[model samples]
Target: MIRCSAQTLVALFILTNITATICCPQTCSCQSTPNVNVDCDHRSLTAIPPGVQAQTAKLDLSYNKITTLLPEAFNSLSQLKYLHLKNNAISVISSGAFHGLTSLEKLYLNYNDVITLPENVFSSLTRLKYLYLNDNAISMISSKAFTGLSNLYELTISYNEITSLPASVFHNLQNLHRLEMYKNKISSLPVTIFQTLDKLYALDLGGNNLTTFPFGIFNGLNNLNVLMLMRNKISSVPIEALRSLPSLQHLHMFNNLLTNVSALKDLQNLKTLKLDGNCIQVLQDGVFERLTKLRILYLQRCCIETVFPSTFRGLSSLLNLYLNNNELKTLPATLFDDVQNLKRLYLRHNELTSLPSNIFTGLPLEDLELDHNKLRHPPVILSLNELHYLSLSHNDLEIIPTTFPIQRLRFGS
Candidate 1:
């Protein structure tokens, strides 16, 4: 009798629903000022709290004691865009735990105890964009774990105990941009493991136990930009495998067992090359001839005793050269000739007893570090106009040259 028309009654029902949705849960603190955000983190919670608003966009439940994710645990949060479950003791996750979270864009399960990812564990999150599972104990992952995450952009699973990966584990993530799995126990990879990841931009596989790469290991990654394979046991590399990465810019292979680097001559777009902590005893001429766009080169701690004069022939744009901590007793006079744009040179902790007078000629050198060497005499530093700071510290110099400008020089131990 109170409602005169059906339209008025429906409008009253909608108003009542809206009022119920904005109400905050009793246990968790909610904010409706900006978007609906719920903060349930660090509550020592053993389970998901009840009465969380259905309109909440962000829900933080990290640092809790929840051990397992039951199925349909978050079924009521259909509007959740970000769910933070990091730093939890979650070791088991039901396959349908996220069945109703269709709108979830980012999921943080890092720093948890998840040991394995069962099949269809995340198939319901079709619109997920970012997934962070780093610092977990995940060692086994089903090939279909990420079956429907087509829109995923970045996936970080670093610092885990994974020893191997299925070849088709990432076959569905066509739009994935970055894949970071560093600090794992992976020793070898399937040859076609990354054949379908054409849109991938950065791949970080450093800090692993990889001994060497199979031929055509990086076949279809033409768009790859940053490749970090440092801290492995790779003694040698197949040149054909490196030749496929035409778009690679940064290559970090430091702290490995590589004694020869003739495989890096074809990286024309390379800008940064880090090869420190190896055993390459000598540098042949034109070794880096094709890397004309290289800016930074790290050859320190390589046990290098001899460097050919034309070793840096094509490095005209080189800015920083680090040859410190080596066994070099001397250097070629024209070693720094091709690197005209060179700014910083590091030759510390070497066996250099003397230097050629014209070694620093026509260089825009700014900072020169020759510390911790056996040099008995200083190099010609009078003609270097751009020289600002020169460190001759910890050397065996019997007499400091009077004609050389000592204003910017540091000669004491």
Candidate 2:
């Protein structure tokens, strides 16, 4: 009995070696040093390679010519945790194509020619955590397309041709945290489209053709932090559109058609606000009175010619301010009185003729640009003790002012 047991042990070792040799396909290279990783990327194959080892964990099939994903195409790869099929011509995915990949946690299907997704195509991948469908030509998605992916956290479908989505498309994605649908043709969204995404933190809808923001569309997103609405056609923002977001930190609404910013008075938790490239002509008083936590503010290229004295009264914690490329002829004396923490201030490319003597007193500015203006003398009359860089080029200054603090200055152009 002892001799028979030794022979059986030797036979089992031989069989294991044989299986490893035949498991790796001829068209791909497989490695077992760091737990079976396959590198089949850039292979111009038309179909999924056969004989992939069942123990393989990571598979890269990007930049391939594969056009179709038949049913159970990856059934042999039951242990696959990451699959890459990006930059492929894959236009069709039959139902149950990924039927056996229950452990798949990340799937990359970006930059494909896929135009539509059938229902139940990814129902078997229940453990998928990150799914990238960006840069695809997808225009239609079935309501049940993402039915079983309960553990998904990030879903990016940006840079597509999708014009609209079903109201119930994201109803089951309870754990989703980040949803990016930017650079699409989405003009309008249903009122209840984002009602179920309560845990979402960042939502980007920039570079779309949206004309108006549906009122109360963002009522339930209390935990949202970043909201990007740049490059849209939104002409006005109703007061109720952003009153519910208490946790919002960054709000980007640049490149729109906004003529007034009175709708942003309630977002007290805001840190950065971008309102550049709009049609705003004047800064109204108390428009930003409640934003005490504001740090960075951008209002460039808004065609402004006048600013009220109390426009920036409550921005005590402000650090960076941009007011370049405007039609301003003069500024109020106390326009920046409350912004004592300002470090970088851009007031270039304007039509200013003179500046107040005590305009920059008791402030710690690092970089100040006043170029391309109609100033006949140095703009800063008060001593900037911590000033390091200053630009006075392209101005009408006949001679440098004697009060200009150039002792500790680093650069002047």
Candidate 3:
């Protein structure tokens, strides 16, 4: 009888403990989603959980092994904002993958092996801000891939095998900010490729087989700041190609077959200029006459033998000057005449043997790089009191002058 009483007590204790273990899926570690935010990212579950219909704002399901999403995957999630499924095995969505999500802000599906976006996949996401579909096997984006995403800001569709983008792909994304369509088989951009995106800040058209510069294109984009036109067969940029951008800051036109630079003189707000790897042996005398606000200039690996003395006279705000790895033996006497703000001057890997008299006449320079040159003596500057970093080690100099040790400069090879 005592043994039976002890067994009943043990049974009661075990049953009480089992009943105390509550099953809360939302807070349960074994069954909870990746992030427990009101907007959550759920991954690796056999199916979408049930309670996400009321919550979940930003769901990032990238790099998972899910094959299918239920038709009600996001059926009633009213607060959902961003949905990212870039690198997943999601093979199919049952038409209403995002049926009731009206507040979705961004959608990223790049780098997926998906073959197509269902016809009405994004018909309800009205406020999407950014859409990234780069590096995907998506053969085509339904003209409706962005059906109801009226306030979309940026879209990147690069590095894909897309032969052509639908003409009206960006029709309703009127407030779009940036678009990248580089490294695809797109031979020609549709005439209206950038029709609705007036607020775009940067546009890249590099790494294509374009033979002619697309003129009459920037008439719509009046606020573009950075434009990249590298690695194309473009001989020269038309003067009118950029006559509309009054606020352009940086212009990248490298690796093109060009001998003239007059077209770039109209950009008054230009800051950084890169013209390396081109056939520009002699720059226009007033090439940078209008670029007074220029700061960083890179002209490495060009056919420049000697920079014209008056070439950089107007660049008062120029700071970094890179003339390395080029075919140059001497710098013009007036190279540093008016550059009062010159800081980093790079003349490395050139065939220079002697420093010009008054080479650095204008301003406060900190970093001077003259490595890999055949120099036997230090650069003769009238005043290098502000110099900080100096590189002249890999040359024939066995010793430097005691006076060469400026207060802030560091000597190097």
Candidate 4:
């Protein structure tokens, strides 16, 4: 009986040892959804804790004071698929820091102090599809830093101090779709910088120091949809610069130094065009003759003083037009004749004193903004049967016309 009792105790001791090894770490909370998920976020821990199970699939370690990511920091979490390390003070990431995480698909390292990316820092993350390094101080990225991210679709490096990029930096990212590098100090790019990004759709390079549009820079981006170049120092946009972007729909070139826009006859698929805050003084006829698909046009604060009679000849699909904050003193009576689908017009902050009685005849206009102009009388809006919202405040109105269509108005503020 004593021998049998001793054997039973030994068996129990072995089982207890196995249980302790697979237990959750002391600083983290673990939940099992068939696969383990560990939450150690905001724990004030200085480093990754031990005793984490090997089957952990998701780990949250954000909002911490972790200073460095050692090579062996995540050596055991091989099954980790989603790792959140954002909002950390991480400044140094040792080589092979993510050595065994082969199944990692999404990684969040934004809002950190990482200044430089070592070559092959992400060599183990072959399946990584989404990587967020935005809101960091990353000034330099090695040409081979993204060596193993073959399937990456979205990469965001916005709000950084990166001044330039190697021409071959994005050569391997062929499957990348969206690239965000706005709010940086990038002044120029190699003409072949984006030669390999064939599947890219959206590119945002706003709020940079780019002074000129590099010709043929978008050569291989045949599927690009949205291109935002706002808040740059660009003075001219050559037609060759945008000739390859046939799939582009929304083009935002606002807040630049462009004096005039060349013919946009190639962008037949454009829907929204924003050229506000420029030095555009005149609108040449047929400048937008081919943009029949354009719906909304923003020309506010463009310093426009003269608009030709056929300035809006081919914009039959235009719904909203904004010409506020210009120096226009008069508009041609037939300026908006072809815009039969126009619903709203904004002509505020100009020096207009009068409008032709038939300026808006036979239209379905809904909203009209003529405020802050030098108008002495309300322009004839009797033909606008669908007019509901009108703003005539801050003008030089003297007498309120008794026959005005004020009954159909909903709000006039």
Candidate 4 — worst ten consecutive residues by lDDT sum? 1-10
Question: Which residue pairs clash in candidate 1?
Answer: none
Instruction: Give the runs in model 4 whose Cα sits over 4 Å from its true position.
Output: 1-22
- Tell me the tens digit of each residue's lDDT in model 2 across 1-413: 00100111224546443222324667787776656778788879898887777888999999999999998899978889999999999999888899999899999999999999777778899999999999999899888888998898999999999998888788888888899999999999988888888888999999999988788789789899999999999899989899989899999999999998999999999999999999899898767889999999999999988898888989989999999999999988888888889988999999999998778887889888899999998866356777888888889988886766677675556
Q: How close is every model to the real structure, measured as TM-score?
A: 0.94, 0.93, 0.83, 0.92
Model 1 residue runs over 4 Å out of place are 1-21, 408-413
> How many clashing pairs in candidate 1?
0
For model 2, state the Cα shift of residue 151 in Å: 1.1
lDDT of 2 at 100: 93
Residue pairs that clash (backbone atoms under 3 angstroms), model 4: none
Task: Provide the lDDT at 53 for model 3.
Answer: 30
lDDT of each: 0.90, 0.87, 0.72, 0.88
What is the alpha-carbon lDDT for the whole of candidate 2?
0.87
Q: Write the per-residue lDDT of candidate 4 for residues 1-413, one digit (tens) a residue.
A: 00100111224546542222235777778776557788889998778777776788999999989889999788888999999999999999999899989889999999999999989999899999999999999999999999989899999999999999988888899899999999999999899988899899999999899988678998999999999999999998877889898899999989999997874567888999999998999998778888999999999999999998899989999999999999999999999998999999999999999888899997789999999899999989887888989988888889979999778886555
Give Cα distance to truth, residue 54, candidate 4, Å: 1.8
